[model samples]
Every structure is written in C-alpha cells, then in structure tokens.
Target: MDPRADSPDDAGTLPHVLVLGGGFGGLWATRALAAAPVRITLVDRTNHHLFQPLLYQVATAGLSAPDVAAPLRHILRKQANATVRLDEVRAIDPHARRVALAQGQLHYDYLVVATGSTHAYFGHDEWAGFAPGLKTLDDALAIRTRVLSAFEAAEREDDPLQRAAWLNFVVIGGGPTGVELAGTLAEIARHTLPREFRRAEVRDARIHLVEAGPRVLAAMPEDLSEKTRQQLQRLGVQVHTGDAVTAIDAEGITLAGRRLASRTVLWAAGVAASPLGSQLGAPTDRAGRVLVAPDLSLPGHPEVLVIGDLASVTQDGKPVPGVAPAAKQMGAHAAAVIRDRLRGVAGEPFRYRDYGNLATIGRMAAVVHFGRLKLSGLLAWWFWLVAHLFFLIGFRNRIIVLTNWAWSYWTYQRHARIIVGRPPPDE
Candidate 1:
C-alpha cells in the first residue's frame, strides 16, 4: 500500500511500525496489523505479557506467577510480519521517528507508545518500601512472602501486642485490586491460615481496606459500590471510606488522623502514566499522560501514536477509563488508522464504546453493572469468574486458574501459598 511501491509485491519494503509494551494495548495493535503491509517490532521490558487483573490472586497466594503470564514471542509466533523484542525503551526521538533503548535504538515509520501506567504513591515514594504495590510478578511474590512470613514471625512471638502487629493487614485503596487483595487476605486468615497455625490464633488477624475516595469502586454505579462494600465487611474486611493515608513505615500506616500498627501493607492506590509518555516530547497531564489527538495520534506528529493508560483520550466529555477493554479498543483504533493511511484514506476520529463494570468481593459475592442490567451476589460472582477465565491469554493458564479456583472453592485451601526468596529451602 506504499505510494512509492510499483506494485503490491513491493509492500514488504514499506513502513516499519514500532510498538512499545506488551500489555493489552500493544498486543492487540500488533495482532490487528497482522495483514497490513508494515513490519512490526514490539518492544517491552519483560519477556512475558502479564494478565494484570489476575495478579491479585498471585499476590494473595491463590495462583502462581506463571498462571497469569505468557511469553510475548509465543503469542506473536504465528504473525509473519511481527517480531518481539525484550528490551526497555529509554527515550523517544520524534523527528527521527526512533526510540532509545538501554542497549540500542530502533527506528520506525509509525510508532505506537502503549507503555501503560504504574502505581503512584501520591508523592510519597518512600512509603513504597512499607506498602508494596502488586503490579508485577516480583511484587506479587514479595507480598506473598511478606504475608506468610508475618504469620511465621507471629508464631514465634509471645507478646500479645507484637502478635497483633503481625496479624494487622492494611490495604490502601478500595479499587478492584485493593478490594480483591483485602478480601483474599481475609479469606486466608479466616480460613486457610487458621487450619495451619499451631500456636497463634491466625483467624483473629485483622484486614483493613482504606480508601480516600467517597466509596469503593467509584467507577461503578453507586448501588453496586455499596453492595461490594457490604460484601467485604461481611467477609471481615474493615472498610474505611473517605480516609487518607498520611504516612507508612515498618510499624504501620497513619490514616484518618490515627495510627494503625501493622507489619504488612498492600498498596492498590492511584496510578500515574508510565514515564515513557514524557519521552514523546508532547504535553502531558499532571499524572504524566500524553494528550492524544482525535485519531489517537500525537498532535503535530501523526506518525507517532500513544494509547492505553499513557494517553489521555476522552469520549462524551469523560476520559476513557484505564482498563483492559479500553486499552484494547484504542490499540485497534490506532491500527485502523494505519490501515487507512496505507489505502490513501484518512481515518475517522476515535470513539470509545462504554461497557459495564464488574467487581468481586470474595467467594460467591460480586457486583456487575451492564447498561440497564444490574447484578450482585453469587450470580455476579459466577459471571465475573466466567468472563475472566474466557479473557485469559493461554489455554494452560485458563485451566490452571480454573483448577485453583475449584480447589479453593471446595476445600478452602490455597495450594500456591508458598513463599519465595529469603525463605527456607525445601531441603
């Protein structure tokens, strides 16, 4: 489809598209452009693409890391024009249409920047050490280790206050990830650990879910949010809304003008766009997200595109929510634009379709909002279970996750609750 090409046979020498990140955005864009004439080079810091929504299960020791991730090369192996590179992008050169990597540089006729977002500590980066966020496999494993180690440490301590500190688990942020982590932690303490603990009464462990917002799952309908909040409380999660954390350290967190003593804290709070957005040399929002054009391209640089959580795009005067569906839709739109350019046709402006929201509390409890339909309790949980399993990347992952869920559902036991690093060797 290149204008300079004498015929279709010469299209292989046409444009080169460079896609950054292997999340939902970049992966969908790469697959969408499969039949296009351009050659695609997908670069990401990690070799495997992670299913972030399921990462909570790993953090809570319900699933292993491998159950939620798949190799990028394995995904694109069938695409003849697609190549995967496990490299980190350092900077972007718009004039040259190239990206600077740690080891080398890459040039592209069309660049898709979908590097996604990272957990933000709200200008309190130091709090990161105490309240680790679950965004990667390492983060999940680290949290698992901390949670399990806390119980083990408590077993050795005889002082009541020290044991209480070990059993106090505080989760900042009431979004889906926070709620899930808090709920699963409650399940583990109230069910799994109680059966295993010999000396300490682990069932007395306190789990708190604190949110600065007015309600949990603010993105969802108010009724559903309230429903989810109720379910969490029923499962023994202390829900604190309209509360902000002022500080976090080895001891615990200070929130709502009070100090809570705890050794393990999980952060599922606010997120800022990945630092890669600034490399585009474009205007970015306060959270460091690039403002994209109507067609999902960088202003004054149509060849350079930004999507996913890194780009700020609005529909009906509302910014597109940073979710897997929205990211995939934006990626497809960007691919369509490139396909249009190849046919010498101008692409239409991007439009986002609004889908409903879903949030689960614990086993057999969830909330869902789909247009006029609203559901909660066990029915919604079933829907949530099916949707996530269907969206999982690999057949093996789906099977493993389903097996794990069934095992937990029947026995109230977590098979993958083993800790990594710093733990005693099996031998």
Candidate 2:
C-alpha cells in the first residue's frame, strides 16, 4: 500500500520529498518540487551546486569557482517549502523509505537519488594521487597549483631535463574536459604566459592530450570529432588517440609502451556512479549506475526515483548521455510525475530529449552537432558561449561570466590562474 494511500485526507499535508546530492539533478528536483504540495529536503556534502561544464575554466584559471557555482540556500531562499541539509548520505533503505546520513537518518514518501558520479581510476586507484580529475573546486584549484607551480619550479631549475619534465603537461583523456584543458593550455602558451617567466622559455611547455579512442569527442559525430581534433592540433596541442595509458606516476606516464616524462597530469578519462545506487536493491550497470525504468524509478519501488549520473537510462536503443541537460530533464519529469500523482491523476512516461552535443577547442572555435545539423568555427563558439552563459545560475554569475569571457576574448589572458590553498604534500 502506498504511504500516501493510508492517509487519503493527508493529501494536503505536504508529502516529504528527499533529494540526495545537490548536483544538477538533485538541485533541479528540489526546485521543481518547491511549487508542488511537497516538503523538500535536499542533502549534499557541500552547500553549493557547481556548474560542472565550466569547471575547466576554473582549473585553467579562466574563471573562479564562485563564478560557476551558487550557494544552495541562496538559490532556494524564496522557496518556503524547500530546505537544504549539508549532510552526506551514508546509505539508503528502500523498504523502509529511509536514508542514513552521517549524523542521522531521513524518512520520506518520495526519495530521489541524484548523487552523481566520481572519477574512476580504473583498477589503479594509486594513480589518483598523481593525476587528479576535475570534479570539485579542490580538484580545479589543485590543478591550477600544479600547472602554475610547474612554471615556477622550472624557472629555478638548472638542469634542462628537469626543467623539461616540469614543463611537460599531460591530460589523460580526449573528452570535453581533456580537450578544453589542452586547448586552454595552448592558449596560455601562445598568448598569455610569455611574460610570466624570466629564465625558463615558456615555449618549451608541451601539452599532450592522450585518449584510447580513435578520435576526440567520440560521443559526438565522426565529422565533429575530426573537426575538434583538427582544432586541437591547430592550437598546438599534441592530440594522441588510439593509445592507452598503461602506467601513471608522479614522474610521468607510459602510453602505448612509450614512456613520457612529466610532472603534471590531469585525469579526465572515466567516471563511475555513486555508491548509493547499490542500496536501491536493483540491478546496476558496469559503472555501478542503477538500471532505472523509463520513469527513472527502481523496478519494484515506484516511490524511489534515480536521476543524473546515478541512473542508467536507455532511450531509442542508445544510453542517455550523462550531461546536465539530461539530468535537468529527468529531474523535471520525476517532479511532474509526483505532482500529477498527488492530484490523483495518472503520470505519463518519462522521455528524454537530446538537445545537442557541443565542445569548444579555443577562442572562436567550437563544434556542435544537433541531429542532422552540423556547425563549427566562430559561429559554434558564439553559440557555446551563449548557451553556457544562459544556463549558469544567478544573474550575478551570468554577468560575471560574460564579462570574464569578453575580457579573455580581447586579451587572450585568463585572470583566475592564481593558485590558492595548500595542495597535498605530493602536489
């Protein structure tokens, strides 16, 4: 029996909706439920919802963390029905409709698991210490420190080999993050950092983007992928595809049996779903993503819904890409379903709509593929900028981001490259 069914008169009592993880999905779910006859409790380890698409800009010193993120409370301050809890989820009990947190537990009539994903070092967990992935603010800051500090260390080094090792930067992935990082580094080399160094020649900096796939942006169309590869190469990024990194260490990386010495390596290769998906009592894919139904609910537990990177959704025989737009749509669909059911109406099936695929190479260069439509070069770059600016939360953030982009465009210099905070002792 449905929990709400036991108390029919309690329909207006405001059903409790528990949303886990304040990422794109959970944030959207909480926002969508704010207007409904529901009390929402959003839980996350942090107080802010990060805009992950522009995270590369943060890592590369193009933008600061706040410019791409907003506090959760500030975002939902006006929503009286919604509240946020800065607590980490430890476990989920589907049968009892309870989620175990670090401090206590939360019970709900409707539970949404949008805990998102984390980087997968494959089987080599030790590699993470050397090659950090860009997921959170700390990771970006750490990368910035490593990149900037490398130049500093090289300037003082007397040995040529040691200086070259410090100047060598490797990005282990050819996806959007890797491509963006590599392209930005090229821009820094070609335009920005010449004056930063007095002794070390900045031109010796080598940026290599390594990928196991045959081309960059493999998820996109082949033509677009080729275009991106060309753009990356044109920007002086060494695009290496069809070769896998066999080993990674603080000293360097070994790819396709070839050893390359480097001190800075960024990982953008793989991602796995959060561990909360295992508590759903449902089947999961290889990446530990819960295999959710069309409605994004566990097989026998309709009250329990999963979205974002945690839910493995297949549509039209193709798995839905784990992107922000898809997560937002899933969150909205789940919200609409709950709202309709609360009114004693049947809920419709959830359908995912593919907006398009876009990846930027550098200034005035990007590739976009939407169905049969294909665009690249300056026009696509403009579209990418507009889309990212429009989607960024908060008017202040949008304005700040637009101003930063305009400044970077005319000057070809990234402003937020200063490394702050203490990194790990090894870094």
Candidate 3:
C-alpha cells in the first residue's frame, strides 16, 4: 500500500497513536505507521520539521529557514489516518494515559514520546542569557542578528578595543555544530563580509572555538579528530582544547584563567532531554533521558513508547547516542511494536543499528567514522553533504538546498544574510 496515498478507510477505527514532537523521531514514527490501520496524531510546539543537521548553515546565512524546514501538516496531509496538531505538551499523566497540552488533553491508546532535547548549560543557566545555543529557528535568527549586528556596530565604534570586541566571535564546545559554526563564521569574515564592510577590516575578525575536551570531535576516531583540528586551524579558527568556559556575559567569555572579549557567543556544548520525560515521572539518566525497556516502552507501560533524544535506550549494554539516524530507527521500531500489538502478536525488543558518524569542518573538509573504518577531508565532506541532502524531505527542499550549496560553493557568498526585526527599539 502507498502510505502517501489517501484511502476511504484512512479514518479507520484502529487504535489511536499519538506521537509528540515533529522532529526526526516523531516524523519517522508517523511515516512507519502510515500503512497501519491506526489513527495517528502528531503534536509539536512548532509546525515544521527541522532538518537540524543544516541549522548551522541557516544561522551562518548559508541557507534560508525554508530550505531546512518543511511544514508538518503538508508532510502528512495525504495519510488519511494521520493528523497534525501544533501545541505544547504541558505534562504526561502516565497513570491516566493522557497527555496534557496547553489547549486541551489527548488520550492515546499508544503513545510515542519523541520530544527531542535542548541545550544544557550545566548548572549555570545564566550563561544561556549570553551564549544562546542553536536548536530552533528563533535561535538561528537570533544568532544571525547578533553576528551581522556586530559588523554594523563595529563600523560605528571608533575605539579600537570596542571594535575588536565587536569583531571577535566565540563558540563554546567542539561538537559538530560548534566546529561547523566556527568554520562557516570564519569563511564569512574572510570571504563574504569583507566586500560588504569598507570601513572596518572584516577579514581581521577573530573566531575562537573553545572545547573542554582535549580534542575536537571527540566522539569520532582519534586520528579523524586530530585531522579536523588541523583543518579548522587552517581555516583561521583558533582552536582551544582542554579549556572550559567559566563565565559568559554580554561582553565576552571567561575560559580557563583568561578572559576573551567578544560580543557574540554560540553555545553548542551539551544537551539535555526535554522536560516531558521528567513530567512522566520515569527513571532518567544523567542527561535527563527517560530510561525505556528493550522494546522502547516505559517500564510496565508497554502501551507507551519513548524514543529519540528524550529516551535512553541501550543496545549490547551500551547506551545509544542521540543522533538523527538513531532516533529514526527507534521510531520505526516503536511503530512496528504497536502494529504487532494491534495484530495480537508478541513484539520483539527494539535494536539499534550503528550507522557510523560524520562531521564537516568547512566547505571541503570533513571526518567520517564507520565502525573501524575512518575517512577524512574532501571525501568525507562529500559524504556528509550527500547524506544530509538525501535525508531532507520533499524534492523542492532538496533542489533548493542543492542550489544554495552550489551557489555558496561557486561564489563564496551567503544569500540569507538579511537582518530582520526592528533596530533594538532605539536604545
């Protein structure tokens, strides 16, 4: 059966499945269960499914918001058994088997909690006021405004020190997002913005990547991480390993024992699960992820399944990382289990397949680690680009993204660099 096609029994009297969050996991779950004789309702705070891997590009002006996001309603509108709702989930009453939303309640015969994650500032939540992480579209636009405004403000400042602070950009963490951001920002300063700003030396802007670990891309192989560090340095990004951020303010960041003066700070350090897991009163790991059973179901509540960044699942006694593919696999597995239960058949435990990892440093530099095999440089970058492009939903988005990437590659220009919103409300 074509899951995308509408049928007369699309509104079948099968079991009702409610999936939360329009991210990778929830979207995948909805797709996997499309052919099943079940009514599906997908809920999220936002109305779009974000291609998170390319969110940094949006923030850095490489791609527009629409290029990396697709409307949720448009995606599942053809599936007769499926519906989309834009609402914030306030709480989950597991005993009552109901999800409380800001507007009303949703009763689920089978629940899938794929609420995803948010940036964690350790215990120093105040730092978030200065160093905003890239998670949502608003965060991307806010960072873009701060970045572009720095150049505008620099042009007006006569004091050299103040201008330097405006030109300096600091990114916390050495993960994929941080590394990609630092590299792209460096390119923008060195290649793109220099022509736009005549008065100030945009090329002289400093980009620093601060990481607590001894090396960048610590999750990857050792050699790949070392190579990435070198590639980033070649792009003129100051790589600071073994350095932890102590404080962050509007002026700058305090790392190790020294103070770095900068007006722009991007936080990509760590992430914690969404508050929905805690609301369920389920056992969570250190990262605040719900600990689920082998079948991706809450303990003693087989009817409810939790996957993606919100749930902590183990395979071969090792915990799964909160990545896109992992989430997709878990979501598919959860849907299978629900289908089996509806068919009066016992379901097997969910198993996650290791699908390697990839992180790109700059335009043609990347690192990929697939089990024991590792590759670096341009080849890895190509792989990364193709993988991301292949995963994005809809042909129109794929064409748009490809066009944007090709344009950026040929001209070294970012088209989505426009600054929106009112100008700081006039001091």
Candidate 2 residue pairs in clash (backbone atoms < 3 Å): none
List the candidates' TM-scores in order.
0.95, 0.95, 0.95
Clashing pairs in 1: none
Steric collisions counted per model? 0, 0, 0
Off by over 4 Å in 2: 1-12, 423-427
Position 285, candidate 3: lDDT: 94
Compose the digit string of candidate 3's lDDT tens values, residues 142-256.
8888788888888888899988998999999998999999999999998888988878898999999999999998888888889999999999999999979998988998889
For candidate 1, lDDT tens digit of each residue in 1-427?
A: 3242223452357698989999999999999999998889899999999999999888888998899999999988999999898788888999987688876777788999999999899899998888889888988898889889889988988999999998999999998899889999999999887877788899999999999999999988898899999999999999999979998988889987899999888899989999988878889988999998999899989888898999998788898999999999999999999999888888789898877888778989888888998999999999999999999999999999999999999999888878788731210
Q: Cα RMSD for candidate 1?
A: 4.3
Candidate 2: 10-residue stretch with minimal lDDT: 2-11
lDDT by residue for model 2 (1-427), tens = 4342223442347788989988899888888887787888898999999999999999899999999999999999999988899998888999998887887777789998999999999999999999999999888898898888887788899999999998899999998888999999888877888887899988768999999989999998888998898888888889999999999988999999989999989999999999888889999999999998778888899888899999998988999999999999999888887887688876677798998989888989998888888999999999999999999999999999999999999988889978787644643
Off-target runs (Cα >4 Å) in candidate 3 are: 1-12, 422-427
lDDT: worst 10-residue window of model 3 = 2-11
True-vs-predicted CA distance for residue 298, candidate 2, Å: 1.1
